[model samples]
Target: MSDVFERYERQYCELSSNLSRKCTAAAALNGEQKKQMISIVKTGIDEAESLIRKMDLEARSLQPNVKAVLLAKLREYKSDLNNVKTEVKRLSSGGNYLSARDDLLESGMADTLTASNDQKARLMMSTERLNHTGDRIKESRKTMLETEELGVSILQDLHQQRQSLLHAHNTLHGVDDNIGRSKRILTSMSRRMNRNKWIIGFIIAILIIAIALILYFKLK
Candidate 1:
């Protein structure tokens, strides 16, 4: 679902960008060139409309929270598309208006009106470009923040793993210490048992000698 949405969304952005560039190019063109650009713009508008429909359909099929976000984005994109269409229509009309007024070129008022219209068109184009730049900046900031959050989460996971490893290392050291102590205690016990055996053998030898001496004296 998300993949489809992103595909359509990416295509729409590209289409819109193409249309914007064509529109800007139209401003500097005339005669056959301008006519061809206008044709391209019309076709792009149709493609844009189709993409919008696909996006809207995918958005509606999504979960409530996600759907809401997509719908809002769709609404904004629709407005931007409308703005592009309006600008194209304005350009076409401006061209026709200039041609129609060719006969009145000698009139001062006609010249002033023409200059004013041209200035207004340029101003509108500048404003549109400015708005697009602002939107791009906002998107960049959002991406940066999301990246930072992911980085922080990864760091937290690493810290927890490090702590667990440290605990295991300490436990092993303690076990080694206990094993050494137990070995020393067993060695001390073995030495005491050997000394007791020697004492018992010496006492038995003295008893045998005294018994023999008493027997000999009785016989004599």
Candidate 2:
């Protein structure tokens, strides 16, 4: 367990540093390199987060001292994951700027040098705004899809839970019926036993009276 936690911690630390460096160098990165770096960081972040979550679960059953250490490691990994996520977001947002810059520089328009500062500034601003808007629209669509999937999953889980509860309720109801039948049977048997006891007592009383009368006649 300790080894596992240590490994995850080391991996997270390494990924965090790599992502930070990548973000710092993002302005110099070409489109392909940026995409590759983003992919690496995203994958590493997911792995690190998963490892920490596993560590959390394993720590629950460990001794106090070991559990504390594991928990601390988990926190460190989580922090690193957050840092990596921030770097990724930075890179993603900068991607549009990089693309627009590349487009403008590669256009080789002869008038670009003669263009006024105000005109260039306006063009740059318009390009960036359009890119950012497009990115936001894509993100919104992604979020909507994810939310719909989550809702479906929740409904399925609720349906399963309801089925389980209904089954349990039916089982308890059957048990109650069995108990009622047993109680009725017991009451009927008890009444029959009491009636039989009374009949036996009356027969014994009559037998005793007859014997007493015969004995008294012989003596007189």
Candidate 3:
């Protein structure tokens, strides 16, 4: 990163020095020389602008304090470059100063820079979209994991309930068996009590009859 900044700074310094020299000499030159000077100025300004852009990009990756210093430096470079461009325009202000070719070249350089900036903008937008998509996918994955855990918990509860129901059913079956056994025992006891009662009544009536016959004999 520092290397990139150094390269841009170096280029910016060279372009600035070269433009100032050419602009200083531009007033004394003849028509062709002045045109050449203007041409050099145009090219230097373009290169300087390019370097400033590179430096600006490098600044973006820097620490905030360092980035601020670099940005301030870049702004100064831009201002100087703009001044050079204005000087060139002043020198070439007359009618029919620049040829159609120079105009075409300048326009082409501008178009290229604009296209590059647009491409970078598009790339940034695409990266942001990809980030959003990744975030959503992560959230969806988390939701799916939570849902899976919930499902497992529900299944576990169902299994526990089923076990409890099976245990209850077994207990009820045992209780039913005990109740049936108790009913049978009670029925047997009732039958035995009824038989004993009948036997006792028969024995009592026989005693009474025997006693009456003895009384009649005594009377006779």
Candidate 4:
């Protein structure tokens, strides 16, 4: 258990340390900075997934609800990171100058100042959202760690609950399969019985007609 905890801790530390470096590098305006940010976000996601996997393995009984919440948070971070990348690309493409043209006009710069102001506002908003996303990621990580700690206390309860749920699910699945099979069998049996009934009626009608014909010929 200590080994598992140590591994998780080491991965978390490595991820956090790298994140700090990436953030510093991203403060600069260069292609390298953008690349670093992308790499960092990817690494963060990988580390989070690794942590979750480790928790699952060690716990032997992780709460599905908790896992679901953590996964949702991770997805939110991924979306936010993608949005940040998009904003960076737009600014780098000179779209910012086009967007703040109104602000530029007030400064006798025709459209440039207005466009710059609008772009700045957008950039500020994007930055805020990015920061918020970072905070959320941090909170999620903390929650995950806390859950791991609590797992020791709740292992027996969680194990029993998980087993009960699994058994219920399996039983329901089996019942559904049996019901389907029974329906098919009944349908096939009905068809066969109906066909045989028709065949028997036809044979009886033919035999009666033959007897009538013989009686008519004998009377003649």
Candidate with best TM-score: 2
Candidate 2 CA-lDDT value: 0.72
Model 2, range 134-201, lDDT digits (tens) per residue?
68977995897587557656765776688799999999999999999999999999999999989898
Write one digit per residue (lDDT tens) for candidate 4, span 1-220: 3456457646655665565555545546445456556566556756655664554445444357655654454455445445544444443333333333333345453477776776677667756666687689779978986886576458767768889999999999999999999999999999999999999999999999999999999999
Cα lDDT of all candidates, in order?
Answer: 0.81, 0.72, 0.74, 0.62
Tell me the lDDT of model 3 at 74. Answer: 80
Tell me the TM-score of each prediction against the true structure: 0.46, 0.49, 0.43, 0.36
lDDT for 138 in candidate 3 is 67
Worst 10 residues of 1 by lDDT: 99-108
Clashes of each: 0, 0, 0, 10
Candidate 4 lands at a TM-score of 0.36
Q: Model 1: how large is the Cα RMSD against the reference?
A: 15.8
Q: Could you tell which candidate, 2 or 3, scores higher by lDDT?
A: 3
TM-score-based ranking: 2, 1, 3, 4
Worst 10 residues of 4 by lDDT: 93-102
lDDT of 3: 0.74
Rank ordering of all candidates by lDDT, starting from the highest:
1, 3, 2, 4
lDDT of 1 by residue, 1-220 (tens): 4899999999999999999999999989876688789889989998898788778767766688998999999999999999998898788767655544542343335477787676566556655665687589669957974875576567657766887999999999999999999999999998888888888888888888888888879887
- Screening candidate 3 with a backbone cut-off below 3 angstroms (N, C-alpha, C), the clashing residue pairs are none
Off by over 4 Å in 4: 1-151
